[model samples]
Target: MDTASPAKWVPHPEGPEIAFFDTETTVPSRKGESYSLLEFGAILVCPKRLVEVFSYSTLIKPADLNAISVTSVRCNGISRESVGSAPTFADVADTVYAILHGRVWAGHNIVRFDCPRIKEAYAEIGRPAPEPKGLIDTLPLLTQRFGRRAGNMKMASLATYFGLGRQSHRSLDDVRMNLEVVKYCATVLFLEASLPDVLSAATPIDELPITRTDTDITTSSNETSVLVAHIEEMKLDSSNAGTAPSYTTVPIIEGSSGFSGYLEPEEVMTQHITVSTLPFGQFAKMAVYHKDVPLHLCCANLNVCFGVSTKFLDNAGRPKLNIVVEIPENLCKVLDKCDEVAHKMSQEAGSISQWRPLVKKDGYVNLPTVRLHIPTVANGDHAIYSTEMYQKESSGNIQKLVFTKVDASELDTLFIPGNMLDAFFDLDVYDYQQNAGIRLVAKRLVLHSK
Candidate 1:
C-alpha cells in the first residue's frame, strides 16, 4: 500500500449516475487465509443516457488446500492448475481501482462484506484502495422499508420485482443485477431521491419494524410471563367482542423518545384498571387519570399496566391501547390505585370535552396552513400533518418555534445550528393542517429554548 497517497474520488452525479460493483472472492475471510479473486465486475449507468459495463476475471495461486476447500472449485469452475501461471494481485489492482474510482459503490450486501474485502485486497497489494464515496446496501434497506415481506430481499427477487431478467453467478451477470438493484432502489425505495440524499440518509444499523409480534430478547423470566398475560388479555377482549376488530400491534422500540399513541377510553368511572405489559428498556412512565384528575402514577424498568385502551386491535385480533406508563426500575409496584383517587380520576375523565384538540401550544402561530421542515429531525411533539403532502414535497421540513425567554446561545443549543440551516428550506404551509378546531396527532417535537 502506498502509505502517502490514497485514491481520492467524488461520487457520481447526485441523481442518476451510479456504479454497480460486485466481486467473487475465493473465501470470505482475510485472517489466516489466502485465496485469489475469481472475478470482479462493475456496471456504470447514467439513467437514460448511457450504460457502461466492465469485468475482469483471472485465476490465482491458492496458498493451500484449505483455500481450495473453502472456495469449492466445483462452484467457481477454477482449478489449482489454472491459477499456477496467473498474474499476481498487484497486476490487476489498478484496473479494478479505475473502474470503481469516483463512483457511488453499490452491491447486494456491499457495506458488510464486499466493501471490507476490497479494502483489504488493496492493502495487501501495496496500493491505496479506491474510495467509494457512498454505498447502497439492498438487504437492510429493503427490510426496513417493507417489513418482513421484504426481509428476504435477495438479488434474484429484487430483480424479478423490477422486471429485470435472470442473473447468472458470473461477474458480468452479477454486475447487471447490481445495476437493477440501484434502479429499483432509486425509483421505488428512495422515491426518486438523489443518490447523495439516499446515501446520506442510509443507516448502518438495522432498524427493525415497530410491531407487537417482535419481542425484545433481553426480558427476564418474570417479565416474559407478564407479556404473555398482556397478550392473553387482548385475546380475551377480542373474543368477547364476537367479531374481530381491525388492529395492528406496534412494537414499543427501545429508546423511543416520546409517546406513540393516546387513549380516550369510553368508561369514565371504571376502577381497578389492570395493565399487563413488558418494558423494552430501562425507563418507562405511566400517568393515570380519571377524566382530568390524576389518580395513579408509577415508574419502572419492567413492563406493567396501570391503564388500557381497547380502541385499536392488532393484526392478530387483539384490542390495543396506548400504554402511557414508563418503566424506571426492575420491580416498582406493578399496581397502583386508591378509592379516593379513582373517584377523582373518574370525575376528571367525565369532565374532559370530547372535542378537545389533541395538541395544544400556548403561542402556536396558525400561519393559515401546514408547512414542511425539510432536512430537520423531528422532536416528537408536532403532528405529522399528512403523509400525502409529505410525499409531494421533494424534501422534508423543519419545525421552528420562537422562545421569548431564551437568548441566541441557548436557542442554538435547543434547535438545529444556524450554520447547517442552508441544507434545509421552509416547506409550503398550505400542505399542512390549518384547521383550529381539528385534533391532530403530534408525531414530532422541536424544543426552542429561547
Candidate 2:
C-alpha cells in the first residue's frame, strides 16, 4: 500500500445522495512506490432506498505508461494499451469532481487505498481534490456490524458469500458489488433482529461471539447499524475533580494536576505493585494493581516521538490507533517493574503467547519510548475514539473535545510528532493468537498548545 498520508476531507453540502465509488490503480512493483490511477467509477444512490441515481466510469492514463506492471494487469486487468487512448486524469478531473464532490462518499477499503490516490492524482495536476460531506466506508462498517461472516470481509468474498457472483476487479463492478453486499447483509440482520431470541442465543458474555463448535460464519451476535446523526463537537465544561476513578477500585487515585483519578508515576512505589487474576465465568483476567487498587498512571509533558499510527489493524480491519512518546526515567522505572511482574503472571496463567515489552528502546541513542493506544468502539455505522481528549491552551485553559464521527484524520492533526500531552492510561494485558503484551490504553489525553 502507498505510504503517502491520505488527504483530509473538507465539508460539503448536505445532499440527499450518497456516492458509491471505486478506483483501479497500478500495483506498485517495489517498496515506497506509489499507485498510479488507471480507472475511476462511481454511482450516485439515494440515501433512503439506496437506489441508483446517476453513474459514471472512465479510464485514466498515467503520465508514465511504464508504471503499469504485469502484476498490475493480473490484479485489475487494466493494461497500458487499454488506457493508452483514454483521457488522462487531468483531462477528466472535472467529470470526476462533479460525480463525487459534496456527497456522502461510500466505498470499500477506500479510506486506506483509494482516498490517497484520488488526492495525489489531484495534487499531481496542481488541482484541489474534491471533498465529501461525510464518508461511509463499507469495509469497517460491515466488519464491525456484520462480523467475519463473509470470511475476510473483502468485496469479492462478500459477493461470493451472498451468491452475488464473482467480483470483476474493475472499478465500476466492484462498487456495485459493495452496495449489493451491504444490502444483503442488512436484510439478513433485519430478519434476525425481528426474532432475536430464536435467531440468536443470549449469552452471559456479550463480547464473546455465539457460534457453532465448528468454523461456520453464522453468528448470533449480529449488531444492527443505526442511522447516524450529524457530527457534533462539544467542549467539556469541567472535570469532576473530587469524583472517584472510573477504571480503578475505591480509595481513589488523586492528583492536583491533570484530571482526577490519574496518578503521576513519581507517586507510585515499585514495591506496592502486584498482578492478580480475577475469575470471569470460565475465564480469568490478569491485571496490574498498586497494592489492592487497579493501577493507572498520568504523566504530563510527554513529547510525541511518533504521531498517530494506523499501520496496525485489528482482525476486522479496524485501525488500531496508537502513538509513540518519549517517557521520563521516573515513568520508565515504574513501567519496567510492572512489565516484569505482568509477564510472569501472564505465563503462569497459561498464556502461550509471546510476551512483548511495554517500554521500548528505539534508535542508536536508546531513548525509552512507550506506545499509548487510543482504542475505538463501534457507533451507529462507524467507529469512534474511546479515549477522551482535551486541548490545553498556552494560557493553561483546558477544554475537552467530543467527537461523534469516525474520522481518524482528526487524530493525525492532534497527535502530530513533537506535540506534548498529559496522558492518563492503564495497562491492558491480553494473550491472543500467540501474541501477548501489556498495552498502555489511554483513557484521557490533554493535548498541550504549542
- Per lDDT, the best of the predicted structures is 2
Using TM-score as the measure, the top candidate is 2
Provide the TM-score for each candidate, comma-separated: 0.36, 0.46
lDDT of 2 by residue, 344-408 (tens): 98887778888999999774226789999999988878777789887665335566676766455
- Local accuracy of candidate 1 as per-residue lDDT tens digits, 228-287: 342223221211221121222233333543322322222224454422222436733223
| lDDT (Cα atoms) of all candidates against the true structure | 0.37, 0.70
For model 2, give the 10-residue run with minimal summed lDDT.
228-237
Pairs of residues clashing in candidate 2 = none
**TM-score result, candidate 2:** 0.46
In model 1, the number of clashes is 41
